[model samples]
Structures are given as structure tokens and as C-alpha cells.
Target: MNVFGMGLPEMALIMVIALLVFGPKKLPEIGRSLGKAIRGFQDASKEFENQFKLEAQQIEQGLNTPTPSESEKIAPKEVATAEVATAESNNHATTSSQQS
Candidate 1:
């Protein structure tokens, strides 16, 4: 079997060296810790991928929705300004008639 681009013989040699460097008693503990670390990394990577996908979906939805044009955005403000100007002119006419 090839693992990390190493053939079976290379794997066997590395395993033998590891066993020699760390005795049989310590090997199981080291393997267990290594397994746990890999599991944790996998879990974290999955969570990050999920969050990224969720954010991308939200952005895509936002982009899909319609946005107001410049004129549409300005319309309500223009109407309100026109109403205010009319009210002010009416008030001035009333005051001038009262004074006359």
C-alpha cells in the first residue's frame, strides 16, 4: 500500500525506526494521541467548510434580490420635499392675506 507517496517497504522501514526510537510501550499512547489530533483537525476543517458555504449562500441570495434604481430611491424624498414646499407657500399666502 502507498501512503503519503511511500510504498509498503518504506512504510515498514519507518515503522521499524519509530518502534526502535520509541519503545513498544510508548507506541500505543503516541498512536492514540496522533489519531485524536487528526480527528480534531478533521472536525474543525468540516466546520469551517460548512460556515464558508453558508456565508457564500447568503451572499448569493443577497445578490439575487432586486435593488432599487437611483430614481426609485430618490422618489419618496422628492415627493416629501414637494409637499413641504407647497405647505410653506400656503402658510405665506395666509399670513400675507391676514396682514392686508
Candidate 2:
């Protein structure tokens, strides 16, 4: 079998070297630690991918959904009309009083 582009022979050689260096007793502990590290890395990578996807989805939804323009965010037309009418009336009242 091939792993990381290394054939069985290459894998066997590395294992032999590691066993000789660490000895049989320490080898299992090292293997367990290596396995645990790999598992933890995989879990962290998956979590990061999931988080990235969730954020991307949120951004996509935000883009798809409509936002209010400047005019839409402002007060409605009816209120604006009423305010203008009141100002005009006040101007008229002022002019009438000035004439009197």
C-alpha cells in the first residue's frame, strides 16, 4: 500500500528505524500520541471548515436579502408632506402678521 507517496517498503524501513530508535515499549506510546495528535488536528480542521462554511452562508444570505435604501430608512412620504404643509402655513401666518 502507498501512503503519502511512500510505498510499503519505505513505510517498513521507517517503522524499523523508529522501532530501533524508540524500542518496542516506547513505540506504542509514541504511536498512541501520534494518533491522538492526528485525530485532534483532523477535528480542529473540520471545526474550522464548518465555521467557515457557516459564516459564508450567513454572508450569502445577507447579500441575497434586501437592505433599506437611504429614502426607505427615512420617515414616510406622508409625514414629510405634513411637515412641509405646517412650515408653509407658519410662513403664511408670519407674512400675514407682518402686513397687519
Candidate 3:
């Protein structure tokens, strides 16, 4: 609804006031400090996000794994073999019944 969320006249007035209050000598210093603070905040936030992601990944892997201190793992191949053995026994029983 307004330029820069403020009236153009209001922005000009604020600029004039800031120029008078801080003067040319201090505005550059203020800008520099503000830039540094923004950069530091960005760096810190990125580091926090990276750490959180790493912790989440570690938790996921932990949930998917069986360690030496935990229960033994069941491999897919072993499961498949067990299933095949059960099916073979069932077939043999049916074949023997048919023969008899």
C-alpha cells in the first residue's frame, strides 16, 4: 500500500533525520556493523541446521541397524531361505498325501 511500507515523503523525512543524527562519518560504520551481525547470524543458523540434520541422520541409521550391543540382525537372504524351506515342506506333505 505504501512505498517500502512507508510513504515516499516519510522515507525522505527519515533519511534526512538519520543523516542529521548519525552524520556521514557514522553511517558507514553502522552499515558495516549491521552487515557483520547479519553474516554472523546466517553462519550460526547454517551450522545449527547442519548439526540438526547430522543428528537426525544418525538417529535414522541407529533405528535401521542392529549393533553388537543389541539383538542380532536378520538378513533378507536368510528370511528368503526359511520361507523356501517352509514351502517345500508343505509341497512334500501334499505330494505324499496324494501318493497314499
Candidate 4:
């Protein structure tokens, strides 16, 4: 059997080295901690992936949905024209008062 491109013999050599370095007493503790760390990392990665997907979906939905325009609620062109007319009227009134 192969694991991470390493054959059984390579795996045995690695295990033997680890056992010699750590001794049998501490090997199980080290293994437990390593397993826990891997599990935590996997969990974090999955959570991040899920969050990214959710955000992407939200962005896609936002892009697909049409936003309500001011023109839909109120006549934008009319409102703009009204504003311009009011400004012109105010300028005329000011000019007349200044001449008088």
C-alpha cells in the first residue's frame, strides 16, 4: 500500500524513527494531539468553504435581483425639470429685486 507516495517500508521506517525518538510512553499522546490538530484544521477549512459559498450565493442573488429605481417610485425626469424651473425662478426673482 502507498500513502502520500510512500510505500509500506518507508512508512515502517518513519514509524520506527518516531518510536525511537518519542518512546512508546509518549507516542500515543503525540498521536492524539496530532489527530486533534488535523481534525480542527479540517473543521476550520470546511467552515471557511461553507462561508465562502454562502457569500458567493448572496452576491449572485444580489446581482440577479433588480433594484427599485427612484424613477419607479417618483418621476425622476419630472422631478429634475421641476428643480431646474424652481432654480430659474429664484434667479429671476433675485435679479429683479437687485435692479429695483
Candidate 5:
């Protein structure tokens, strides 16, 4: 079977070389460690992918929802009217005192 672009013959050659270099006694231990390493890497990658997706969803929701500033924009005219009325009253009081 194809694995990392290496066919059956290539896999066999690599196994033979490893066996010759490391010997039979140490090979099983090495294989077990290698399997554990690969499993850990896969778990970490999946965790990172899930975390990324969750953050992206949160960001999307934040963008879609309206903020306080956006709601304030709709009622600014009433605030402006109140400000104008207060200013006019202040101007009238000042003029009346000056005339007296």
C-alpha cells in the first residue's frame, strides 16, 4: 500500500534497514513510542482545529450582532433636541439678567 509516497517494496527495505540497525529487541519499543507520538500529534491537531472553529464562530456572531453604538444612532435626534432646548433656556436667562 502507498504510504508517504512509498510503496510496499520501499516500506520493506526501510523495515529491513531499521531492523538491522536497531535489532529486533529494541524495535517493538521504538514502534510503540512512534505510535504514541503520532497519536498525540493527531489529537493536538484536532484540538487546534476545533478551537479555531469555535473562535471563528464567536467572531462571526460578534460581527452579526448589533452593538450599543449602532442602537444609539437611531435615537440621536431626540438627544439633539434636548440639548438645543437646554441651550435656549440658558441664553434666555442670561439675556433677562443683563436687561435687569
Candidate 6:
């Protein structure tokens, strides 16, 4: 069996090494520490995920909230002129493409 892509032989070898180094009595204590470390990592990861999700939601909400730009506060005539200029440039591109 592969545990997180570790083959059975690899796992067995690791266990054997651990047994030799720690002995049976200390193995349980090491295992407990390992379990706690894994759990702590999982908890921290979850909290980080939750925080990112919260920030994303806040950003989505801000996008929906209308904030008037400087242009929006400007005169309508200026906006119309800008739109016409953009449309002319777009038309020019389209004509160039069609000719090609």
C-alpha cells in the first residue's frame, strides 16, 4: 500500500529504522507527537483557507458597491466625446482586419 505515494517497502523500511532508533517504548511517544504535529498543520491550513475565503467574499461585496470615479463625477459631454473616440478606434481596427 502507498501512503501518500510512499510504496509499502519504503514505509516498512522507515518503520524499521524508527523502531531501531527509538525502540518500542519511545515509538508511541514519537507517534503521539507526530499525530499532534499533523493535526496542528491541518488546523492552521483550515484557518488560512477560511481567512482567504473571507477576504474574497469581502472583495466581491466591494465590487457590487458602487463607487463613483472621477470620470463619473465629470461632465456628460466629456464622457460622450471619450466614447466616440473609442468607437472610432474600434471601427478603424475592424476595417483594417476586414481589409487583411
The model with the greatest lDDT is 1
* lDDT for each residue of candidate 6 in 1-100, tens digit (9 for 90 to 100): 7689999999999999999999999999999999999999999999999999999999999999999887777868797899999999999999999999
Query: Ranking under TM-score, best-scoring first?
Result: 2, 5, 1, 4, 6, 3
Q: How many backbone clashes does candidate 4 have?
A: 0
Candidate RMSDs in order? 4.0, 4.6, 10.0, 7.5, 5.2, 16.5
Those runs of model 1 whose alpha carbons end farther than 4 Å from true positions after fitting are: 76-100
How would you order the candidates by lDDT, starting with the best? 1, 5, 4, 2, 6, 3
Q: Comparing 3 and 4 by lDDT, which wins?
A: 4
lDDT per residue for candidate 4 within 11-30, as digits (tens), equals: 99999999999999999999
Instruction: Give the TM-score (vs. native) of candidate 6.
Output: 0.64
Q: Write the per-residue lDDT of candidate 1 for residues 1-100, one digit (tens) a residue.
A: 7789999999999889989999999999999999999999999999999999999999999999999999999999999999999999999999999999
Model 4 C-alpha RMSD vs. true structure (Å) is: 7.5
lDDT tens per residue, model 2, 11-72: 99999999999999999999999999999999999999999999999999999999998878
Model 2: residues with Cα > 4 Å off, grouped in runs: 78-100
* Stretches > 4 Å off in candidate 5: 68-71, 74-100
TM-score of 1: 0.71
Q: List clashing residue pairs in candidate 4.
A: none
Per-model CA lDDT versus the true structure: 0.97, 0.96, 0.88, 0.96, 0.96, 0.95
Candidates in order, TM-scores: namely 0.71, 0.73, 0.53, 0.66, 0.71, 0.64
lDDT of 6: 0.95
| Candidate achieving the largest TM-score | 2
Which of the two, 2 or 5, has more TM-score? 2
